[model samples]
Target: MDELKLGLDLGAVAEALAAGEITERQAKNASKFINQVKAVHEKPLKARLIQSDRGQFLGEAHPLDCGAWKAYRYGPEFRDGGKVFPSLEDAEQFIING
Candidate 1:
């Protein structure tokens, strides 16, 4: 079997599998290999600390890959408030206000 290249789209592989062009094992292997490669190359999103006007730490905001930002309130544990913002500024505001 040919080695699957990095960044292979699993959608195409699924289509191939459904079309009976590739075996189930081959499709699973391709998916696993692609995910492994993605995991190795992808880095965790670092949350930027949000501060108040008085220089007090509010919380943190992490930018997502989908052009959105997620805010987490700082406390005993960093917890997401179940809200997604369109921009980092919006997320920071949420952290500050909430």
Candidate 2:
């Protein structure tokens, strides 16, 4: 996986804590902050995003077929039972913009 750039300043947080400008709790919270990261290397579908002439993006179900690109989690049964995209467009936009 590629390293992600988190635009945060650890030194600044340390300085603020040292100067008593921020609580130790706040500094600790800042230090432990996590950014959401998800990989989109696989298709939400069985085919490529731009497969043959029958691209799903152009089908009648285009805008609603979000299972292809949205992130999801499997239950203990490995079922499709976790978070899903609100729409295909939203997922596509996120991938394109990010």
Top-scoring candidate (lDDT): 1
Query: How many clashing residue pairs, candidate 2?
Result: 1
Which residue pairs in candidate 1 have backbone atoms (N, alpha carbon, C) closer than 3 angstroms, thus clashing?
Answer: none
Candidate 2 structure quality by residue, lDDT tens digits, 2-75: 11114355677677788887888877766555222112224343422422244433211123353454432222
Worst window of 10 by summed lDDT in candidate 2 = 34-43
Instruction: Give the alpha carbon lDDT tens digit for every residue of 1-98 in model 1.
Output: 35344547888788878989889998999998878777766875477988999999988887888989988878854653647899998898888988
The window of 10 residues in a row where model 1 has the poorest summed lDDT is 1-10
Best by TM-score: 1
Candidate 2 residue 63 C-alpha distance from true site, Å:
25
Taking all chains together, the TM-score of candidate 2 against the true structure is 0.33
